[model samples]
Target: MINVNQITHHFVLGKKGNKTIVPVLKNISFQVNQGEIVTIVGRSGSGKSTLLNLISGFIHPTEGEIIIQDKKVSEFNETEFADFRLQHMGFIFQNFQLIPSMTAFQNIELPLILKGMSENARRKTTADMLKKVGLEDFGEHYPSELSGGQQQRVSIARALVLEPPLILADEPTGSLDSETEQDLLQFIRELNRDLGVTFLIITHDDEVARIGDRTIALADGKIVESGVFA
Candidate 1:
């Protein structure tokens, strides 16, 4: 589970010598329960991605506390955050962030490689994940050789291969067509249901938000609305 309390973030933008503070998130607070799918919906500049970044430990909040599984991570330095992310969080991006030169199998295997998992273990795990994502036959193909949906499948497989407890997806469906988007969302839902992996997804799409167990609406860096959809 993840808990964010009274978090605020801002950045300095301007010349090197002269900078102006631009706020991104304003007193944002939320909690994600175990085995639940929570969506943060917002338009551009609404700070949805900033909130996700804060949660994922990509960037710490300027002020406030971020507690994951009972540990306060808001004060963690970059090195600590990097270790935490590898151990606890899986990330999916709108761009599918796959390595261009790696084949599907290799791409999915990268995390395990980084973790120093045994070659045999990585092979078995990566192959099983490929099958789980319905990419069993395409592991040998490079990203350039696959369709958009297939490439995203590879990306999803990579994200899940490590079996991290939490997945932080940012605009996961932005690059897909409507049909593919639905399929991908349904796959995510099934993954949540079957694996009990908690998900916190950030997106601007209402349809995407509707797929979650609960939706938190954000605007102007604040939570405007939040509720579980029946």
Candidate 2:
């Protein structure tokens, strides 16, 4: 469903004349098939996050092309990518990334609202999402009012409310306790199994990596290994 073809990314440090180019990702190529959970695992400074950002269109790749669902997204400008993202991609971040002032219901409904869905339709969709995430009763609660697990569930609901085909998650279980991490992983599996949603997850934990159908390991900005998880 997604392809990263020979992409290279670097950061220019210092002023123009004295700038030093520090490469973050070098010659990275991979593919994520529809309905598969592919996890990218790497240590700090491995450029895993950079790869995710590039794929998410938060940042353009310095080189190479990114095709998603057959669209050459790498060539899209910010406005185009923003619209495409809302219609095709979902995101789950480690910190939940919820608006503390907005109630869970409002947070989940935001995407639908942005899509210009009628209030009645958005309300129904958001409510259904909250139920799917097991947060039906917590809909009125704000981010600060919920536990870490509950907040993450709300984040998942918000991401899935639009029913995007692909979900890109960065360190999804990073902030949770072991039990909560396992719970969230199982929930992710369920979402993939029941909804046929494809996942591309970035994680450093082995336990987290084990849940993937395949794992790609990166080191020094290169893919050192890619294989089915044993």
The number of the candidate with the highest lDDT is: 2
Q: For model 1, where is the 10-residue window of minimal lDDT?
A: 221-230
lDDT, residue 225, candidate 2 = 96
Q: TM-score for all predictions? A: 0.97, 0.98
Local distance difference test, candidate 2: 0.95
lDDT for each residue of candidate 1 in 114-227, tens digit (9 for 90 to 100): 889999999999999999989999999999999889988998898898899999999999999999999999999999999999999998888889889999999999999999
Task: State the local distance difference test value for candidate 1.
Answer: 0.91
lDDT of 2 by residue, 1-230 (tens): 99999999999899978999999999999999999999999999999999999999999999999999999999999999999999999999999999999999999999999999999999999999999989999999999999999999999999999999999999999989999999999999998999999999999999989989999999999999999766
| TM-score result, candidate 2 | 0.98
Clashes per model (N, Cα, C within 3 A) = 0, 0
Residue 230 lDDT in candidate 1? 38
